[model samples]
Target: MNNSYFWLRCRCNEDIVLLKDPKSDNRSRGKAFIYPKERSYKTFEIKYSNKLSTKAKFILSSFNNKYIYYAIDDLLYLLKSNPTEKENLLTVLYSSILALHNNLEINFFDIWIDNIYINEIGKNNRFFKVEEQSQTLTHITLTLFYRTRSPFKKPEAQW
Candidate 1:
């Protein structure tokens, strides 16, 4: 269970942390294991290896030594002041989700919450984009959306 090694990239500044061994590159040098949770859910475990991916390499370049909590706080403050700037707000939330998911590869959950609802944005497209809503600083409604789909979908009974 404690066998996997991981290369964690901090969400705030993309800081890279090489779990277990410190002498090797964060990417291309670890094996991530998927661990089961209390229910039927799965997570990842970190293991050591020597294979790196191009995406991992790009992530490693701007790796910092900090996490995303700090950035989230700052973004929250900005969102509070400028309620109309939609693009910047979404970027902040997206980066935070990425940071949370990047760390601890031993856990097998998705980076963001799994509450997905299907909406027909366009009849011709016939596909759904993932969307999540959060409260803005001034109690306004902020809806965030990404044009993507998750491969995992729990059974209806589980919901």
Candidate 2:
């Protein structure tokens, strides 16, 4: 079987990529696998809505035309050299995850440095205006490789 992935720009202007798992059928056989646990497995459904939540707004505005793809391994190197930048990237990632959980009741199972793409803005002199000082800013976009949702059930009573 051929395994490959590609990126495409969505209508929102953000890059959208689909990642496929080679061993998806045998997911339950391994313990070190990246897929979510069996108990959390739920069917994926989409609810068409024109409204955006406050959390979604904040997350979108955070990456609004501020950065472009820098490098694939930028996060790995940044962890050793720049602590502040690393923290900022992590905060955005976690905040996004939280927002998704709260807004859609969805959960991202795999989140790691490799899944994050780093983008650098204000790094080129040609893109800078005379009045605006150039400052390199790093932004992150996370790719969800695996996700799952649990069935809606009321809390069980403990006696």
Candidate 3:
């Protein structure tokens, strides 16, 4: 199914731009994906939700912060033209896996690349963005989600 994405700005601040998917009909998936605009996988998941509340979740906010950006370029986007950089990132990712080989199991999403890179706040490195000189690589973020469960069951308690 061919779907489209559009920007929705909150009334509090027009600068904020929330990428919304076109309304879905009866044919919809139950899962919802949330990530950057270019990440089409998440966009489709959101559109598949038939409920209005499901679609509204992305735009709901209590603060007056603006989400709009003149340019949302990041390292992932940069790697497209820079083969050397992409190779470097891939190598680093592989090295990370190898380094933790014996420690614990590392499970990745079906499409790991789409699950990585998230927006981060607070202090960042001293690298200044060329387009937005005032802004740094704050959006160049990575977060790991994990769950732990005991393999062995506990014995019966003493009387």
Candidate 4:
């Protein structure tokens, strides 16, 4: 509940163009930002509200601007070079999932690939022992936002 976001200015052709920051500090000033694909803003906010909890919203807020593709490429390189550093990201995912099904007794469907989003939350160069098989530039942080659509269906099955 203590998260913030930036709203989209307008939908560019096949690209997300960030518009402005929320003008007010009101709790519900605007819809949470998302890396939407083939979906309307209303559909993502209303239809997928179930997964928009605090833990998940934190991740959604990370994609408040462009240049995310480049950051992701860097993140992937870091992970590939050092797989052991995946614990932090996995912990966030686990908490988000727990919050997703909090106080619920419903049939949870499998995660759809389209609904999952990952955004980089910048990076910090901290002290870490240089491992022989690891890259020295493993520092980009990340946030995870997994959307929930009703009757979730795997991409392969839709074909």
Candidate 5:
């Protein structure tokens, strides 16, 4: 199984990019691991379902206009320097986790500094509501690649 990954920055939105694998086909012999072909790439936008709460949207919106991307380590460094943001940051993180779990049934095993990003807002250290501050500290855009089957689930017919 050979899978290729690419990061694409859209001309219209520099802050958001698509981390894509052009050869993802479930019908292929090796799903999500097929060789690339000359077919046109299919692009899709990820939108949260209506199941997501208004509060969640409000929390995420606070991250708007922040930096295009920030690594987990960079956020950690920032938190270290400004300890006051710690509580807000954690709240955002937990909210994000719960939202994904409940809304999509997607469990993110790789939740680390390397896999996360913090927006560039609030760099000037301006004060905001706790909820808004949390969003500013924990807003992230992620592109995940995974198999259809749940890795954590037990096989129906165990060998």
Candidate 6:
């Protein structure tokens, strides 16, 4: 499998750019690898029927709000302090991990932790589970499917 590179900024105002498995990078890749590609060891398959409502479970009025940022910071700290081997979670986790370890800050304002819908997606692309307590610190695991392919870029879509 060929790896690619991209950039992201963190809450601390640091820039992070690095090479990583192409499957997860969201910008400029121009291609999307369908699930079950390479991280099979980390993905989990959940039954299709057990679905959660799409209505917004929680919403923060603004990122600039003190309580919102604090809650976000706390969530990030919690996710990083305790690491998991699950690929998708680990993908986001390790991506954040590398950025911080390298002193690069991700633009946390652009990506809302509460907006991450890992549990909402079902069947195929749905890959992990997170068990939380009081919506704070928690446990997470990933289930990867075992099919590998290099998908070509579809026009107007960015992966």
After aligning candidate 6 to the native by TM-score, how far in Å is the CA of 72 from where it should be? 4.9
Please give the RMSD to the true structure for each candidate, in Å: 21.0, 19.3, 20.3, 19.5, 18.0, 20.2
lDDT over C-alpha atoms for residue 158 of model 2: 100
**Candidate order by lDDT, highest to lowest?**
2, 5, 4, 1, 6, 3
Model 6 misses residue 78 by how many Å?
12
Task: Give the better candidate number (1 or 2) by TM-score.
Answer: 2
**Residue runs of model 1 more than 4 Å from their true location after superposition:** 1-65, 90-96, 99-159
lDDT of predicted model 6: 0.34
The window of 10 residues in a row where model 2 has the poorest summed lDDT is 40-49
Model 6 spans with C-alpha error above 4 angstroms: 1-69, 72-98, 103-119, 124-159
Return whichever of 5 and 6 wins on lDDT: 5
Tens-digit lDDT string for candidate 4 (50-151): 122344334433434433343344334544533443334434434443444563321223222123343323233457544432332222223223334466
Write one digit per residue (lDDT tens) for candidate 6, span 23-115.
Answer: 766786555322332322222222222222222123212222232234445445544533331223334434543443344332323222222
Summed over model 6, clashes come to: 13
Provide the lowest-lDDT 10-residue window in model 6: 54-63
What's the TM-score of each model vs. the native? 0.20, 0.36, 0.26, 0.24, 0.29, 0.17
TM-score of 3: 0.26
Question: Which run of 10 residues does model 1 get worst, by summed lDDT?
Answer: 138-147
Q: How would you encode candidate 1's per-residue C-alpha lDDT over 27-137 as one tens digit per residue? A: 755554222233222222222122323332233222222223333444455445444443344453454355444543322232222222112121232253434222112
Residue 1's C-alpha lDDT in candidate 1? Answer: 20
Worst 10 residues of 5 by lDDT: 35-44
TM-score of 6: 0.17
- Candidate 2: C-alpha RMSD to true structure equals 19.3
Q: How far is candidate 1 from the true structure (C-alpha RMSD, Å)?
A: 21.0
Q: Model 4 compared with the native: what TM-score?
A: 0.24
Task: List lDDT for all candidates, in order.
Answer: 0.34, 0.44, 0.33, 0.37, 0.39, 0.34
Residue 67: error of model 6 in Å? 8.9
Candidate 5: misplaced stretches above 4 Å?
Answer: 1-73, 110-148, 151-159
Error of 1 at 86 (Å): 6.2
Model 2: per-residue Cα lDDT over 44-84, one tens digit each: 22221223333333443444222212221343353545555
